[model samples]
Target chain A: MELICPAGTPAALRSAIEAGADAVYCGFNDETNARNFPGLNFSRDELRKGIAFAHDRGARILVAINTFPRASATALWQRAVDDAVEAGADALIVADIGLMDYVARRHPNQRLHVSVQAAAANPDVIAFYVETFRARRVVLPRVLSVVEIAEIIRETTCETEVFVFGGLCVMAEGRCSLSSYATGKSPNMQGVCSPASHVAYEETAQGTTSRLGGFTINRFAPQEAAGYPTLCKGRFSTALGDGYIFEDPVSLDATTLLRGLQSAGVAALKIEGRQRGRAYIESVVRHFRRALDTLEDGSEADIVSLKPFTEGQASTLGAYRKTWR
Target chain B: MSHSSVASRPLPTIPPLLTLAIRPLPLLPLQLVLGGFLQRILRRNPGLLDRLGEHRYARFGIKPVDLPFAFIVEAAPPRLLVVRELPQGLDARVSTSLANLLALVEGRVDGDALMFSRQLGIEGNMEAVLALRNAIDDAGLDLPGELASLFGPLGEPARRSFELARDRLTGPPEEER
Candidate 1:
């Protein structure tokens, strides 16, 4: 299976390549990509340079223009597609059907990958994207178990990519509006979830309180580690308890299940953190590459070393071992 | 409004840091030591400055919230100087505890988690701060290791002492080195 990694900048792309990423996925520095964090992502010239650098070193670059284009601003996304194509992106990962259709009609030869934001869980939805947009691959959403994923792979013609490591979204991709309701900026429209501009923190006598758009998300004691105030991972007061009501502040680590995913005919394993720095990209990619090597040699990979790198210093198998559902 | 729709949301109101609540204490000795340490570290690893490229010229003010003084860092020419007061304008200003800052420099703690939890506060230009962070993180940072090297033949003992000090300060059983 191909080990795909995330890169937010040219420097990070280079780091990922050197660290043994088979392919590095990134996006232009704008709302066209979901990780629209301030000061992260690539410029067009940087993308061109990054693609050349990666391709020269026997690696591929996938451009993610994954955010939904506004009805009045379709031209901007179209231009991004055109620019990415011109920049020699190996493939374009897209979520919007209209944009996919545009790619099919205009750049028919361009290899399209369905973005996870599309949330195509079953074979029928995957087949639809494959048939209509000729999507060569579909990045499966984070809601399916290994058996379900295997079934989908068996039933669909498109290649399958699954996120093996990094942040886990509690909601179905492309469907959740909790962030939009709280901050008025949806990942689908603005490519930002729990935007920093809509976040505030106050060190009070009680604790360090984090709030998003005037609503409290989580509070941390002086000794406790605090996570990002992502709406989905926020601790809330419920009838049950004032704890993580949706999901805990944990990351996904599927290193142990790599063999199962490979047996299920998974084409790619993706690490999701384009907003991370080069150090993070390099370390994670190196570990995953080593694990893949060991797996190829029929050896079990020791994933305990990866504990230090996990978000919130915790890891879960996530939906792959789904008891949550 | 639904998930698909976009609307103009009001910007979040950031509560100002209450410097008045902090008891004024002597911190010049700590600031000088930190400033000297930073200068030595930057000198030894010029690559850290190079990684920032043009952004190296951008000025950063490092303010340890627990300390009374701040230090200004210029990565371009790579200079660190202790300041009695913060400059009027800076590309980025990071405010945190002295121990936390040391922990970050040593790569003993997760920088992202600290930022997320609001333990480390950043003010000023976002791009400069991001660039600075990437550069620092990319350098294979180890404050104790780097500082011990300055001691020549006494490096090993110095490193051990620094590690012990850090352990006492941070006070957590780390799972990974």
Candidate 2:
């Protein structure tokens, strides 16, 4: 019943709230949250200010302390929960069970939302977080079809949130460790995947070759537009040829599927691009808000305008339609 | 902490561009201010680090062993380069000033864009140079703040110098996080 927006920074948060987000989700600058790039994220004080700003506007703030705990840095993760509670975050979006246990016992008043990183697709796991950790909501992984979603809703008591637009994760959100296998960094441990420090590019006599930790992901000819070399979208040399092997490089555009999501008992829709700028936030949130309003008014929402923002200017229904694959 | 310390305390100069990034800047104190500024900004929006590809660390990845060991970025001149130790290393006399390097770093000058446009004189182990680009992705450049802090008052400028050059040498900043 709510439109959840992503806010990577204070400015982005303001943009989302002003643009009409019902709720906003963000994380601290450290390894506790995903999207852990340098020169980004709020300190504890900034989180307090951001929460205050959102509350003043009648919007909710969701703190994402979603990365799994590293054995050595468990204390930092525990402290992140304490700080978010001090800042008055409306909910704690968590993936690690250990962190969940820490919060449930130490700060019982805090609301806990299961992060998509937890990859809880079945009612059993959602029920696990809800029964054990008392999770109020679960952000479903992007791997299920709408029918599977309705089935999940029928069985679980927790609220549901689906990603409607922006980048799509090829692997299960919370469980992925592909980048770590190639480089030593794990999104779970370090809160970053395909970390910038491990990316390499070359403009040989050939067009351009993009590498992640020395592995060639994609090679753009002199003519093909060069996109950033993320691992999932990289061209791999399988027995199959040199092209995007795991998944194609495309943004998930679900404007046409909102009707199905709402009908399938989804309580909310989320847009995933916290690292985006204010302009990007404003544009995407506004578009989706209007789309949802139109749908509520008994009309089909138009989504043709969402093309430019898509990955490589291409969009796909992505696991939403049972037949997409 | 000026380039004066950098001059006599030689780490073996490969090229003026690869080492002392001196031109015009407020100096070490400025580095602290810059870090504070970044820390302040990051404190509010924590997601700003990974947008597009602007992050400093993505340049250091692990696989495909054929990658460069280091990069020498000069922001004022707008230059990004692959640098590796040569077998017969040159003891080229260092002549450039730090003030010039800082100005180049801040976009007060345009040295980097010039190199990209001209495809100028940058030499190294090209095969190995490929890896440095993905070092951030490789996690090689996971610079510890404490390691950065070891420079003491000189830390900020040193880090700033590394960041500015890295930003320039790397591709344009990624779209917002």
Candidate 3:
């Protein structure tokens, strides 16, 4: 299987390729991509250079223009598509139907991969994208089990990619509004979920409290490891008790299920973290590369050594296992 | 030679006796030297501080737990000074060992991984700390190379000494492995 890694900057793109990524995915430095964080993403010139660097090493570059664009501001997204194609991006990962239609009509020869932001979980929805826009691949959402993924692959003609590592979104990808409700800025539109500008951490006598948009999201004792202040992973109070109401703060590590996923006909294994630093990109990509190499050699990969990189020092298989439900 | 093996290599730690030996020395000279080093870094990477955005005004306390002193950095206008005690009203403080701090600054170690392992302690404004991390990571600062560039005529010798010290103190260079 192809090992797809994330590159937030030109340095990270080089690091990912050097560490053995078959293909690296990145986005432009604006809301045109999903991970629009400060000091991240690539400029047009940087993307071109990064693509040249990756291609020289026999690696592909996939540009993401995944965020939903406003009807009045289609030009920005359109320009991103045109620029990415011109930059020799191996493929474009797009989510918005309008943008996909534009890419199909404007640059029909360019390969398209349906972004996870589309939440095309079922085979029918996957088929619609593949048949209409000729999407060559579909990034399966984090909501399906290995069996479900196999079934979907069995029914669809498009290649399938599944996230094997990184952050877990509890809500459906394209439908999440929790961040928008907490903060006025919509993650779907603004490409920021619980934006850092609206987040505050206060240390009191009781504990360290993390608040988002003036609303308390979680509190950690002095000895506890703190997590990022996202609404989905927040602790809350209910009449029954007070605890994590939506989801626990943990990263997804589906490394143990590599054989299962391979049997399920997964064409790519993606490691997600475009906002991460080069160290993370290098380490994670190197580990996954070794594992995939071992698997290809007909041996069981020993995949455990990633604990120190997980959020709150904890990881879960997430929806890849039915027990998570 | 794989990157994973290099990343998993054990990190070096400063000897306790060295830190204790420097405890009684005056801090003024050290402070001035650090201030000059900070200026050099800023001059080389002009966009480093600008990437912090609004957090540029915040005061950041960087404490090397093994050392007797800490550094207080005021990002706006870019001032860095060594302090015996962290002052009040600082926006954020990050505490870790000197070796870990060096590794982090050089991007040899992952900050998130360090934090997850409880080796790094952070207090106060998390957002500001995150912004600072992202800014530093984006700059891709090579501390040893930058330090060597500080010397005029003796740059090659200084770089060789720095590399030797790093290899002996830590492990071999990742590329060499």
Candidate 4:
């Protein structure tokens, strides 16, 4: 299986490749990508250079122009597609149907991979993308079990990729609007969820309170380590108790399931941290590469050792185990 | 746009290290130990040096403002050295509370948030500081693993003990998804 990695900057792209990534995925510095954090992503020139660097090392580069384009501002998204192609990107990960149609009609020979932002969980939709857009791969959503993923892969001709590590979003990919309800910028349209500009932290009488768009998301005690106040990870007061109702601050780590995933016909394993820095990319990618190597060699490697790098120092198999529901 | 606008403006002067918040006596031993530990780490992980050597951070200072002293990181071999005060003619300075700095090292804190809030302040050459941050991040410094690596063969037991003590001290973690 191919090991796909995330790189928010040129330096991170280099780190990912040096650490043994088979392919590195990134986005433009604009709102065309999901991880549009400040000072993150690549400029056109940087993307060009990054692609060259990765190609020189026998690794591929995928450009994620996954955001849904506004009807009025369609030109920006179109121009991004053009620029990514011009920069010699190995593949384009796209979500919007309009953009897919455009790419299919204009760049017929370019490799297209359906982004998880499309939320196409079933084989029928995956087949639709493959037939209509000639998409070579479909990135499976995080809501499926390994059995379900295997079922879908068996039914569809399109190759399948699964997210095996990094942050866990409780909501269905690409369809979430919670951040827009709070900050008026949707991840699909603006490429930022729970944007940092709307987030603020204050030392309150209760404790250190983290607020997103003036709404209290979480409060940490004096010794507690605080996490980024994403709406999904926020603590809420309900009849049960004051706790994380949507999801807790936990990361997804699926290193132990490499053999099962390979058996399931997973074409690629993706690490989701386009906003993460070099150290994160280096460590996580190197570890996964080693684990995958071990799997290929019929050896065992402990995935539990990765817990320290997890969010809140906790990790889960996530929906891959199918025990949550 | 707002974030970029904030970056375009002139930065403010951050307050000096808060001495009253932390004691001065224990810092010497901690610095010496950390210096030795870092040297060993760099020696074992030569890729870290290869990546860090891409930047020139000679005389750059890392001031955990809540702590009593600062760290002067030399870009060449034997990368980290402790200093009493930030010397003159330095290229850049990264000043943050010890907790926040640790969080940054552990990949838990967002550097942009810390910088925008001035909780983590940076002055002088931003390029050099940016390169330094990238290099350090690629090293993937995990607290328990790092401490465990110090004990060699007893690493697993030491790591488990440290984690158990930490769990006892901090209470149960958030529920797994």
Interface RMSD of each: 12.6, 14.6, 3.5, 12.4
- The Cα error of candidate 4 at residue A114, in Å, is 0.5
Query: What tens digits encode model 4's per-residue C-alpha lDDT throughout A1-325?
Result: 9999999877678878988999999999789998876556777998999999999999999999999999899999999999999899999999999999999998999999999999989988988899999999999999999999999988998999999998887788999988898988888888988886676666545666777787989877654544556888898898999988888777899987888999999999999888766545766787899899888887777532655446655678999996663
**Worst 10-residue lDDT window, candidate 1 chain A:** A303-312
The DockQ-based CAPRI class assigned to model 1 is incorrect
Alpha-carbon runs more than 4 Å astray in model 3: A204-207, A300-304, B1-20, B47-59, B74-76, B89-92, B121-128, B153-157, B160-177
Instruction: Tell me, by lDDT, which candidate is best.
Output: 3
lDDT of 1 by residue, A1-325 (tens): 9999998767678878987999999998789999887656777888999999998999999999999999999998999999999999999999999999999999999999999999999999898999988999999999989999999999888999999999889898988899999989988878988886677666678877778888999987875656767888889988887888888888899988999999999999999888766545766787899999999997766643555456666789999999763
Residue B93 lDDT in candidate 1: 81
Q: How accurate locally is residue A36 in candidate 2, as Cα lDDT from 0 to 100?
A: 81
Looking at model 3 chain A, report the run of 10 residues with the lowest lDDT sum. Answer: A300-309
Task: Give, for candidate 4 chain A, the lowest lDDT window spanning 10 residues.
Answer: A302-311
List the candidates ranked by TM-score, beginning with the highest.
3, 1, 4, 2
Task: Give fnat (model 1).
Answer: 0.12
Residues B1-177 of candidate 3: C-alpha lDDT, one tens digit per residue: 122223344466678998889999999998887787788998898767766777888899999988899999986777998888888888989988876777677777777777655567777776688778877876888776787788878877987997777667657646566
All models: lDDT?
0.78, 0.64, 0.85, 0.76
The residue-by-residue lDDT of candidate 3 on A1-325, one tens digit each, is 9999998877778889999999999999789999887767888998999999999999999999999998899999999999999999999999999999999999999999999999999999999998999999999999999999999999999999999999889999977999899888777877888887687766677777888888999988866765668988899998979988888888999888988999999999999998777788888898899898998898767654777678887889999886764
Every model's TM-score: 0.77, 0.67, 0.91, 0.71
Alpha-carbon deviation at B78 in model 3, angstroms = 3.8
